[model samples]
Target: MKTTLSVLVENHPGVLSRVAGLFSRRGFNIDSLAVGTTENPEISRMTIVVDGDEYIVEQVKKQLNKLVDVIKVSKIIPEESVSRELVLIKVDAEPQVRSEIIHIAEIFRANIVDVSRKSMIIELTGDKDKVSAFEELLKPFGIKELVRTGVIAVNRGNKTIKIEEDE
Candidate 1:
């Protein structure tokens, strides 16, 4: 099964390397990783997607919690949270095909961030399945390139897994 892990770590050099190394040493392959600053600059949030069984994933989380720089970790599954991803796609669009592509983009609620004589760049933000569906629809149009910010998630409403200061 696929699991999304949200890790809060000290905003210090080598922390990311150490966490990544731990996964590598354990032979765990991370499908996607996105790290960014949180509301508190002293901490950084990393969202990682990994494929593993429930028991294996629990073990991985336990191992992660053992790291000094790792403040906290939580596995966000669909039943417990809301997850989303962002993607940008550039597709070939001549005059004749531009309108068609735009129409499809509109149907997906994707924004056309850039348009040129021969190409259009679209920005889409939604859950993984929606993004994937949009990409599949555009496949026949000849995608020039694409980029994605992997899955990020939070528990519904007021619930959250926040790291507490180590005393």
Candidate 2:
């Protein structure tokens, strides 16, 4: 099964390396990882996606909790939370195809961020599936480059797995 893990850690330099090392040592491949600052300056949040058996994933979570710098960890799947990803795609576009691509992007609710005589850059943000669908729609026009910010998630209202002060 595929699982998304939201991890809160100290904003120390080596924390990310340690956490990543844990997964690497366990022979688990991280599918995607995005780390950024949260509201609190002393803390950083990481969203990681991994695919593995349920038992193994659970064990990994337990091991992660053992790390001193790791404040909290939660597995977020589709049923429990809302998840989103952001993507930027650059496509080949000239006078002939520019308008058509813009129309399609509008239908998908994507924004055109940059435009040159021969190419256009689009910004899209949505769930994984929605972003994939948009990419597919633009594939025929010729993609020049693509980049994505992996999944980020939060639990439903009024519910969350937060770090306890003592633990």
Candidate 3:
């Protein structure tokens, strides 16, 4: 099972390193990690994905909560959360095949962020499956390079992970 954790931590220097080191010391490999400042500048949210069964997920949550800089940690219910990832792909796009590449990018609704004489950079954002499918479709065009932002997620509807100081 793949478990995703939404961790809130103090937005200070070396905080990321500490969290990563903790996971490494425990021999747990993180599949994906995305970190960004929250609405409050002093806090940051880390979306961490790891493959593990129920017991492992619980252990990870407990360990994260024990870290000094960590404020709160909660498991995100996949079905109840909305997740997204952004990918930028630079594809081989000679003039002769440029339009064909544009057509493919259009089908995926990806943005042509950059265009040059030889190649074009396309930006796409979606869940893991959509991103994977888009990458597969462009493989034949010969990918020059690509970068992806790991998954970031939040709960749907009225639910959320709120940290009450009093509690």
Candidate 4:
């Protein structure tokens, strides 16, 4: 199973390294990780996705909580959270095929962020499935380059992650 953990930690130097080191030492592979400062600059949120069974995930959570910089760790329930990933794909585009590619991008609501005589850079943001489908459709065009910002997510509705003292 793939588990997503939203971890809150102090925005201090080496904090990301410590967290990543912990995962490395435990031999747990992180499928995706996205980190950025939260509304409060002093804090940051890390959205990490890992593949493991329930027991493994529980153990990982406990370990994460022990880190000095860590403030909170919440397991995101897929149905209750909204998640997104951004991808930029550069595909081969000859003049004859440029219009065809543009039409395909329109169908997926993706943007042609850049264009040249030989290629076009398409940017798309959506759920994993949507992104994957878009990539598959563009493969025939020859993907020259691709970059992705790993999944970032938050709970839907009134639920939110807050420091223990705040709640």
After superposition on all CA atoms, what RMSD does each candidate show versus the true structure? 1.3, 1.4, 1.0, 1.1
- Winner on TM-score between 2 and 4 is 4
**TM-score for model 4?**
0.97
Better of 2 and 3 by TM-score: 3
Query: Model 4, range 65-158, lDDT digits (tens) per residue?
Result: 9998999999999999999999999999999999999999999999999999999999999999999999999999899999999999999999
Model 3: weakest 10-residue lDDT segment is: 158-167
Would you list the rank order by TM-score, best first? 4, 3, 1, 2
Q: lDDT of each prediction vs. the true structure?
A: 0.91, 0.90, 0.93, 0.95
**For residues 8-106, what per-residue lDDT tens digits would candidate 3 score against the true structure?**
999999999999999899988799999999998999999999888888888899999999899999888889999999999999998999999889889
Q: How accurate is candidate 1 locally (lDDT)?
A: 0.91
lDDT pick, better of 2 and 4: 4
By TM-score, the best candidate is 4
Per-model TM-score on C-alpha atoms? 0.95, 0.94, 0.96, 0.97
Model 1 worst lDDT run, 10 consecutive residues: 157-166
Whole-model lDDT, model 2: 0.90
Q: Whose lDDT is greatest here?
A: 4
Q: Across residues 41-101, which tens digit of lDDT does each residue of candidate 1 receive?
A: 9999999998899887988899999999998998786887988899999999989888899
Q: Which run of 10 residues does model 4 get worst, by summed lDDT?
A: 158-167
